[model samples]
Target: MPERQAFRERIRLEAAERFAAGAADAEVAKDLRVSVRSVRRRRRAWHDAGTEGLRSAGPTSRPKLSEALFTVLEQELAKAPVPHEHDAVGDRADAARARFQSPGPGPPGDRARRGGRGGLGD
Candidate 1:
């Protein structure tokens, strides 16, 4: 983690001293050069919760996708091979150029065709 800024450390230390000496949070705010609401927040966080409350919540995490599910998909894909149709050399060159330019997850029908379950092979 990065070091705390000099101004923030100063404010926290001064505010802590004022709070410990029985000064009102608003008084601490005025003397420490910070907001009254911030003083109250820091006081509650320090007294009621401790250092954890003063720390950032940190980044959110996404659940990991199952490796077993990916293995199952690979197994299914290996069971059958789909036929591919090709045109003349000129058309093939144009198609390759289009593929390089767009490169999208083509159409859903193309996926089904490659999967061997669509009517094209049937």
Candidate 2:
């Protein structure tokens, strides 16, 4: 989980403490730079389930790449490309993906057919 989310949860837990102390939701919201509606909801949760209700759910979804895979990818991207002769593929998509070309001497049509990032070919 990102540090920001954990920090935000800590903030919400703090709000819960304030709620337990009888602080108003609006006051907590203003102090925390959050919506009054959000404070009201948190307050309700604090009353019902206490601190557990305000905890982070951890990651919302599984990552497409694992940490090890992501680290390998970053390392691969950081390496220099092989020496080759090839025409530039596209003005934009090629620019984005140019750093990672196949071992072949030319740009493959695969990206154009499968659709480049942001559907640059489309």
Candidate 3:
């Protein structure tokens, strides 16, 4: 979990004190720049648990994965060799560009073939 803002911590403390001093939740909320709902919640927590309830809960610890690892993996994959029958990188890229530039499939005027769909035959 992330830490709460310093302003929020201060607001919670001041709001709790104002509540204990007989200020209405709405008035405390307005003065503290927080919602009335938050004021009421803080009031209840202060009444039940005192100032400890108003202290920041602090942040939780959790490990995060590194993004550089992903970029390294992608670069490794892109540099891997293709089969002998396939074109080299430049030729393969040109072939892909030509295929993409061709008309696409649809109805009679579509760029797609309508018969004998031949993928890996599976």
TM-score of each: 0.37, 0.54, 0.46
Clash pairs, model 1 backbone: none
Residue range with the least summed lDDT across 10 consecutive positions in model 1: 54-63
Query: Per-residue CA lDDT of candidate 1, range 23-92, in tens?
Result: 9977787887789889888988778765545545443454264778878888988987878766598788
Return the lDDT, model 1, position 94: 90
TM-score attained by model 2: 0.54
User: Per lDDT, what order, best first?
Assistant: 2, 3, 1
lDDT of 3 at 32: 76
List residue ranges in candidate 2 displaced over 4 A. 76-122
Q: List lDDT for all candidates, in order.
A: 0.72, 0.84, 0.75
Per-residue lDDT over 34-69 for candidate 3, one digit per residue giving the tens place of the 0 to 100 score: 798888888888989998888787645433535787
